[model samples]
Target: MKKKIVFYVRNLEFHAISKNLQTIVNSLDKKNFEITIIVGEKKYSDFILDNFSKEIKIKFILNDFLTSFRSKKYKKNFKNKIFLDFIKLFLNLKSIYEIKKNNFDTFIDYQGMYLSDFLKYTSIKNKITVLHENRYIGITNDKKRKKIKKKFKNYNKIIFLAKEQTNDFKLLYPDLKDRFFNIYNCFDINKIKELSMEKFTFDEIKWVDNKNYGLMLSRLENGKDFQTVLNALGELKKIDKLNFNFYFLGEGSLKSFLEKEIKNLNLEDNVFLLGNKTNPYKWIKKSNFVIMTSHSEGLNNVIIESLILEKIVIANKFKYGAEEILQNKYGFLFNNENYLELVNILKKITKENKKSTDYFPEIKKSYSRFSSINILEEFNKIL
Candidate 1:
């Protein structure tokens, strides 16, 4: 009999976790596993759901009636915190009821935040939670750390995207060492290849055709360290090495700040903030380099995609993110503290004008581990 697996997410926003969950669910072997997704809330752009295969089941815990209570207008009109708490309580209970009713063989909490609570109540033999971000962030308080450790006690396995992330977690919580597992995120390599060939047109394509443009495929947010990127660009300008354009492909609350900073740094001509796109692989295919300057990440999806497309990548040397993926073998890593290092790397790339094709042979071998078959084997081991 096929094993029944269900994944829980608070919502399906346009981010790596949701996208990875969609890819993994779709890529799983249908003959061996039956997949279902349960979302806690509904949103206007749940586009991630549309990518799933027809065989995958999908549901929303908050039906229309429960969803109405979540509106800003409703909250403003009622102004009752108790009512909101009651709603959350009801939803949690309802979530437990619905999940237990499904009789799934395994429950995978994709976000690893709110859904982990269900592990205490559910008796599912296989309980797993996947942490998508650097868990060290925003949990400095001892009480909060203790609470997280306690909450994670009932989980069968706690999945981290990088081996270093797993190692760090074990160091932080030694008692939970046995529960930690590292499953590198999955990707649909074939699908990305096909999508990269799609004739998606952007107006600036011609302007950047002959220019050495770099692509940053991430949300324009503070944590992504756009400030550092802008600073590096400013340094490059001072040294007369700013010969290329850099484009950001995702949208976030930092768009206005980034625009202001770009003008402040006099990089208006060298920077473009293209809003999020349905398909970013085409952009990656067109760029000379892919850059990542995040303060921290579990495992950056763009870094992997850039390597898969064989584009030169320059990323911050985070202990668990870029360094783990690139290892300075497939891509370059610079000191996160020194913007000048990034500037120097950018200058080197512009002077060399080399594509990642220089290392395409090795990149292919390095990236083969992310194939669906290999990832499925990892999942089977955990399950």
Candidate 2:
């Protein structure tokens, strides 16, 4: 019998978690698993939906009334505590009804956020939640940590993208250590190469046309440490070694801040913010290499995708998943805190103008372990 599985996420935004969920959904064997995706938010990018198989079903938990009630328009109109309480009651009841209506064999929380409040009340035997980031990174509060630990007890299993993440989480909740499982995110290698070859005109190609370029494929928000990257560029310019153009392919809250910083650092000519691209692989393929300076990560998908595309990756030695993914051998690793180190590495890479073919043999040997077939076999064991 096909296992009826439902994956729940807060929203299907153009982010790493959503992309990882998409990859898993597409890679699963349709003959053995019947898939359904439930989203908490009503508003989401259909870009992920466009790529999903037709057989996969999608449902929104929030109805039009609840969606409008949660919107800016309704908040401004309805400020009564009694009305707010009524909305909360309706939502909880609705969620409970939605969950109980389906007798799913497995319930997977794709994102660790507690969007599905009624999940704890569900009696599903195979309850799972996937934590995408380093849980203990910025969280310093003891109360919050205890609250999260209590929440994890509701799940039968917890999926972590890196072994380090699994180990750290185990330390936090020693009694629940047996519930944790480390499963590396898988990639569709051939599909990534095929997408890179897609015929799409990038108008900003002129910026890096004949020059060496490095791509940063991430959201422009906190914890990314983009300032360090810009500072490194500033240092490289001072030494006259800043020959390559740096492009940011994703959008976020920090766009204006980064733009101002770029101007302040006099890196207008060396740095370009290309905003979010639906197909980032094309940009990754065209660039000389990829860069990641995140303070915390759970097996960065961009770094993996860069390697799959045969592009070199330069990242910080993050405590969580950086060394595990890069292995400290495949790509360049610099101190995320030290801009001077980043500057030196930037100088070295630009001066070398290294080709992907040089690392092709090692890259292929290392990345093959993350293939879809291998991941599916492991994933099936859990299901």
TM-score of each: 0.92, 0.92
**Which residue ranges in model 1 land beyond 4 Å of their true spot?**
44-47, 63-80, 137-141, 202-208, 359-361
Which 10-residue span in candidate 1 carries the lowest summed lDDT?
70-79
- lDDT scores in order: 0.81, 0.81
- What would the per-residue lDDT of candidate 2 be over residues 1-383, giving only the tens digit for each residue? 99999888867878988878888999898999999988766756678778988889988877666666665433334455567667766665665566668889998877884534567667788888888887554577999887787788778888899888888778778999999999989888888899998755667567556777888988988978898888888988988857688898889889999999999999998798988888888888888888898888878888888888878888898867778887866787887678899877777767877675564447766678788888988888888
lDDT of 1 by residue, 1-383 (tens): 99999888877778888888888888788899988888887652546767779999888888766676665444443556778777788777777787898899998888875766666677798888888887554577999998888878868799998988888889889988999999999888888888887775667567456777888888877678787888989988987947788998999889999899899999898898989878888888888898888888888899998887888988988756788788778888888868888888888788987767574447766577776668878988876
Clash pairs for candidate 2: none
List runs of model 2 lying over 4 Å from the truth: 63-93, 113-117, 136-142, 202-205, 357-361
Model 1: lDDT to the true structure: 0.81
Task: Count steric clashes of candidate 1.
Answer: 0
Decoy 2 TM-score against native: 0.92
Superposed Cα RMSD, model 2? 2.6
